[model samples]
Target: MEKLLQTVRITINDKLYVKDPESSDLGKRIIRESIKMIYEIGFESFTFKKLGTRIGSNESSIYRYFENKHKLLLYLASWYWGWLEYQLVFATNSIPDARLKLQSAIEIMTQPTEIDTAFTHIDEVMLNKIVINEYSKSYLTKEVDQENKEGYFVIYKRLVNRMSTMIKEVKPSYPYPSSLASCLLEGALHQYFLMDHFNSLTDCSIKNTPTAYFKHLVFNALND
Candidate 1:
């Protein structure tokens, strides 16, 4: 009995060591690699087979981690949302003054990370198609039921709420509504990046560096 227990303990320790040199490393690697592939190929063109090949794993192995492609996409989107939350929290942390917090929040929204530019034009085309198709299907399926509405809201609305809260904190006499502020911010970004009119309006120069234009818009909006 004593020999059996010793052998079992040794086997467990060996398994643990082999499985993770540090905890959560394997999962992090999976996510990181998955994001890289998704950004390169876009979600529509990105297959689990390709992802598995890139990550040096089998399709079955990825399936063990994620039930399906849709689930994997959701996971990626959720991870992005979490990243946005972290940025917001970090930006607001040092700004005890509400105005500064608001400025930082706008800055966070306008500034695209290095990860953003890693995607090629082809990647953007494929990804936009995939997202639009998914969203259309979800709308048709009435997937925007009450519970899921909150989830959608959290994706973008929460950022607006944070900004609104900051505005209220800074200028108690002139409080901004969260919904209105969110609409303006979303409109500005969507108009600049996704709208066709932007090309003709800005002589194509602003299109080259949309992030900078986005930051300018945010600053202008705040000043207005």
Candidate 2:
């Protein structure tokens, strides 16, 4: 509960929601229960009616916070990325060795996540599951470009930018820092997902864990 011990509010784009879920009890409940319900039954099978029933609120109450279930999902996914960026910065900011910093960033991004207690309204563990399974759908849509233009992907991009900067510091001559950063992020998520549904597509065994493998790949590529 270290996170809940202090008040930490991770902000998302105001345009992403009809109301800010952090501002009031009902709004927070909408965020909290929606994450649980969505993670339980997949986003496609989730809706305001079910969410309302779970939390004793109505669809209109839920709509007051989010335009629809998709927006709610975006809010959850965006909050996770934002939280991850904070963790990456906090973990790497003090490491004087650029290589060590990069390794720590890899661990933060790739290794399985534990629930963070700072934001009591959020179950970081379940949210991580949702992200691992459904995050790409948030942007793999026809409106991706429009959402990007509207700043919906700012947190995720900022995360990539931060990690890319770390990569550059480790290898100023490296040409594909951004590409590598994104691959590291998306690649790790893919491995996590595939480990569940298509085990052959990934090798996350303890012998060559995903975090360790990414570290090896990154360091070998940079060769710094």
Candidate 3:
């Protein structure tokens, strides 16, 4: 999988960035350091000037890549989703059994993220934490509809549709596959959030894993 991903390029929406970060060393550094900085300090506290100081580049240079911090966050979120979608497609596309295929997709979506060494500049694990902690900031806004129309979320929506198709494969007669799929994806994030900040609100812990809960919920819901 590592070798396969070494040749793979996770594409982000072009509109999300003023310049493509993967196109240059400086751009890559911006992405790499931005992830590190955002992971260290929450997004609300993150700034381009701080990133510029960390990377030893002028703040205006950072703006040459991303118009603003909000666009930067959108770029990051889109990149993460694109990366996960590639993993999902690669892992489950050849599975012959419907139930097992659906289960595998669920596992990929719900399991704890590990660092993907394939992308040297980005840390998948920390990006997952950002997604869990700050992804809502990317879309929870009045401009979300316009962004959606511009396909800012196509990768994420495509991922959900992939899972939804897998669900239908598992249970041809079942209704609500898309709903179930979206729930599994979003619910995993919510459960992880609860486990991290509001332990009493959720049963998922280091041992009880959101992966296990979602697998159980999905399979039972599919009546497998």
Q: Per-residue lDDT of 120-164 in model 2, one digit per residue for the tens?
A: 788998999999999988999999999899999999999999999
Name the candidate that leads on lDDT: 3
Tens digits of lDDT, candidate 3, 1-224: 56866999988889989889899999999999999999999999999999999999999999999999999999999899898898898888899998888888888998999988788899999999999999999999999999999999999999999999999988888889999999998899999999989999999999999999999898898884
Q: How displaced is residue 196 in candidate 1, in Å? A: 10
Ranking the candidates on lDDT from highest down gives: 3, 2, 1
**Lowest summed lDDT over 10 consecutive residues: which window, candidate 2?**
1-10
Pairs that collide in candidate 3 are none
Error of model 1, residue 54, in angstroms: 1.9
- Please report, in order, the local distance difference test score of every candidate based on alpha carbons: 0.51, 0.88, 0.92
Estimate the TM-score of every prediction: 0.60, 0.95, 0.97
Please give the distance, in angstroms, between residue 5's alpha carbon in candidate 3 and its true position after superposition. Answer: 2.2
- lDDT pick, better of 1 and 3: 3
| Stretches > 4 Å off in candidate 1 | 1-25, 115-141, 146-157, 170-176, 188-192, 195-198, 201-224
lDDT at position 212, candidate 3: 92
User: What is residue 145's positional error in candidate 1, in angstroms?
Assistant: 2.6
lDDT of 1 at 189: 47
Top-TM-score candidate index: 3
